[model samples]
Target chain A: MEEVRNQQVILKDYVNGLPKESDMLLKTSSTILLKLPKGSNGVLVKNLYLSCDPYLCCLMSKSQVSHLESFTPGSPIAGLGVAKVVDSGHSNFKKGDLVWGWTGWEEYTIITAPDALFKIQHTDVPLSYYIGILGVHGMTAYYGFHEICAPKKGEYVFVSAASGAVGQLVGQFAKLTGCYVVGTAGTNKKVELLKNKFGFDEAFNYKDEQDIDEALKRYFPEGIDIYFENVGGKMLDAVLLNMKTNGRISVCGMISQYNLNEEEGVRNLSHIIMKRLHMKGFIVGDHFNLYPKYMEMVIPLIKEEKICYIEDIGEGLESAPAALLGLFSGKNVGKQVVVVAHE
Target chain B: MEEVRNQQVILKDYVNGLPKESDMLLKTSSTILLKLPKGSNGVLVKNLYLSCDPYLCCLMSKSQVSHLESFTPGSPIAGLGVAKVVDSGHSNFKKGDLVWGWTGWEEYTIITAPDALFKIQHTDVPLSYYIGILGVHGMTAYYGFHEICAPKKGEYVFVSAASGAVGQLVGQFAKLTGCYVVGTAGTNKKVELLKNKFGFDEAFNYKDEQDIDEALKRYFPEGIDIYFENVGGKMLDAVLLNMKTNGRISVCGMISQYNLNEEEGVRNLSHIIMKRLHMKGFIVGDHFNLYPKYMEMVIPLIKEEKICYIEDIGEGLESAPAALLGLFSGKNVGKQVVVVAHE
Candidate 1:
């Protein structure tokens, strides 16, 4: 085999408000090889597909995320990616095996934390599914609903950002559990995707609604039992008014308030006390132990055509910046993935 | 006993904003005596000390509180109270037994739900202790801190309304756990009580601080790990900015927002995501089963003088309206309890 080298996309500097292409630089270094050194429990892999998630925006920012170290300037920006094993010094992975995990936004990656990567077993389905449905987002939707909310059958479920990666799956999971699921999306296209594709009980374009509380009232006349909280601020306040007694809210993300200097205040949080509600915020990484269980449940659903997943694929390493930034603008229809290299 | 009677303090009308004395009226009517009927597993008691909790504000408002039935106009307002059983059909209690639970703010009450009431096991402690430390508020502090916050030794705990009934207990609990406990009270008197009587590591007057965030930083150089949230609105927003990563907020009450027509907005909640914090709201009633466990833990603390409790006792049943109104004005020193009867 030819002498191996690593190609990496590095963060030029910490971004301010929004990231630009110039904020990241692509470079190829010939100093190192792909093979894992002796005594090193690492996996050297060829990155196939890289996942672009909203949380990456915070990583790109100068501010450090709590519990997670900020990405160092002039280092490769890391995220979830599907990779093929080139060489492995880890007992869990072998050569030519497909895996997915915290791969750099580049053609190849040498991951020291092989434990973070999951070996791809169900290659019968599209391998790309590992980046979205069967990966972090899938486990997120599963745990956030089943574990956090502990939803009962016939309960009302409301999902914000409902057509996005995690939100779509949450809506579907709610439906499978015999819940009346309604979702809010930013656009008509996404609204249609939520109702038609994800099989939500009802979907509404939040942008079109004059009053969010009114829109919530229209959709949830009886009231919301389980709110899959993806967007916070006013949406959360609106949901508070529409929540049933003993309502449960699983705080997945708050995309709307992430970029702003200040987030909107929720005026109706007092409802939590009166209504006896439970609202909890969680990160998927904290619930990583559930990944294997997530795979077991999701793989069958995907194989039997019981679950449908949509991905907006951006081709090549050049499109990575736009793909990552598209999340803020709601440009991507479903899960946004950038293909760094082909098999 | 003379002819059976039901004497009640009925809410005359739905309160528009701050409740007025005219909004409630006391009426005495002969219906059923304060005696449990045959085969009825209930307790008939004369309420001695009734608590004036902030949550009662929500019930007084026309707006709906989910999972809980709102007090209808012309019906007696109910709250946590210390009572003396006149007669009992429930096997749990005998005549002259001191009890505490859901009881009307009146001379006599017929409790159909005998299971809700807890028989006062230790009368050596003040009977009024049942209205604060040994009652729902105390259990709320217990579960909200130990269970919800899951506080560790040496963690930094912040209690809002620290001189108040529940807040004082929470601060004490945090101190018992080896935490650096800081609290905010409205006045100098309350602040002194928080620091001296409640054994808080630090105490601040929220009204005196020009910048709440700055005050928080000044008091807690290291960020707060656990926030026993009682006052919401701006205090909550300020706390959001000063929270440690993975901090826990146990929302017991939101007194600041309770009286407002349009509740104040919290602009820093997005920090929840960045901090990976956990914020949960709970009712003490939901955790009532922990009463025995609470008593087991707290009774000793009180007897050993390891813990101290304070009460703002209103003189008579006639003073109940002013005592209830005093809560909104921050006039009560500690747990606001009305002494309806002495003998």
Candidate 2:
């Protein structure tokens, strides 16, 4: 058997607040074999692209009896990753196949639940897209908007964190559907990307706007029919005032308030009941079965160049921490993916 | 033509805090003639049962902006009321037809848009039920639970303000669907009403429970699958901790935080993204067209005694302000209604 080794990034400890580079440490270790043991159904993979998402910060935090489990300290940090199968014992996956799912933040991984992994059949696009635009983040924007908000052709759609992974895709999808799409970004460059790259009808730099209510009014004069909520808090309160009757809001994330010791108060949520608005929060995994359907629709858009995707790629595992922390600070331009090793 | 005059309940001035009995004054004058004038489509009606909803208190506050329109300081206060058609030039109605919609707080009202009025078809149920269970509150609960939450059988359901107007009906509906249901009320009496009268599996008094998280754990050992949110703030924070993966929260109101100068912060909303949960806020008026469907489901339940309703009735128009303000104080046992003059 070939010599086996895994380069892994482990969580040093449960973080109290925002994670620092010291919280994670990467180490190279030797493995006995790449093959699964007899009678075990698993796949061994050499991980390539790893996703650095905002939610990973929450996973590193101390367990506060949340709805999800905190990532175990000392265990390898796990997230969406694209990898190639070196060896396999599962029926669905064979040796030398490319796959993507919850893989270790490492150069190699032994995934037991190989069923969760999706085999890459289409190689027409960049393989790294599997960790982002064609993966969970892409499906997230698609299902959250199409399924949750049920956007109409002429609806007014607003997305917060508009330059991020899911928000960027949501804005694009809205524009393609003939929506009057507006988005809020943290910086002018991201705002420009929203309008020029993502094709959003209007874009605003929330940081520059003195008043969020005034900002929303300038973007949505007739009122917002759909709000793709990613950054919550004052943004949500302002959006509530600008919502028309029968508005729909898809809650994907609240990145702004996540790390705060005390959460921000939202004063205008009562408008949901008054204006008859519908605001729903969702996750991509719950709607994973629709991935195939999402691919069917999105693949063509990418092929035809009707849809454009921007990704801020960190060169190696060493830069993963900075890349992840950048999400909170709005530093990443688009879908943030860490390149562990080039294919 | 009858002698032309208008008796009205004028808002003396916008209130600052909890509205007092003196904040609103009922002024009497001669009855206005029921005439369409030369070319008007307006219908004239003699006001009957008027709805006393919690939202009216917000309109009374000077600091709050009324969502629809501010009640003119020197003019009559208006709300959803049932009225008897005295004369009509509008196409939909004629003299003697009973109707319900927005009407002024007076003996007689000159309604500009008769189209907003819904004709009374099922007078079999109490006409006041039209303002409570069969009206906005009822439809609110129905669409909020059925459409928003999309609850499944055997799911664990929790409702706040359990014995209040909309909460009572939501709990009953969950029970009917074979779900495990629990509720929170402000008083021991209302808690008892939730368990015995509303058929909730478990009920607690929020006032008695110092630690809401502990209280939620006692009722939901496996965690909550659905939360019908009425009382926002601390209760919402606690419920967020107790929500299951993919939990659905239908935000109907936040009675606890509404009157506050600053709304309370919800620390556990981050759970929304981590748990892949859905928290939706909706208004009843947005789903008004579902009234026929709601009535079809609710009317039979009422007739079969499967649904139980409670209303704290005030005697006349003069008592309307006190009845409405009672909602914030937890004084109203169930739906609060004002009996101006029952047909």
Which 10 residues in a row give candidate 2 chain A its minimum summed lDDT?
Answer: A62-71
Highest DockQ model number = 1
Question: Candidate 1: where are CA atoms >4 Å away?
Answer: A1-13, A20-45, A64-76, A85-97, A108-116, A119-121, B1-12, B20-47, B64-78, B85-99, B103-121
State the lDDT at B170 in candidate 2: 94
DockQ values of all predictions: 0.50, 0.49
Model 1, B1-343: lDDT tens per residue?
Answer: 4555566778887776778877877777735565567788788888899899877766787774534566888778888898999988888888999898889888888898888788888878889888899888889899999999999999999999998899999999999999999999999999999988889989989899999999999988889999999999999999989998789998888888876789898887767766777788887777777878888999989989999999999987768878888898889999999998875
Interface RMSD score of candidate 1: 2.3
CAPRI-style quality class for the chain A–B interface of candidate 1:
medium
Tell me the lDDT of candidate 1: 0.86
Residues A65-119 of candidate 2 have per-residue lDDT tens digits of: 3444688888888888999998888888888899999988887888998999999
RMSD of each: 4.1, 3.1
Evaluate residue B66 in candidate 1 and report its C-alpha lDDT on the 0 to 100 scale: 36
Residue B120 of model 1: what lDDT? 85
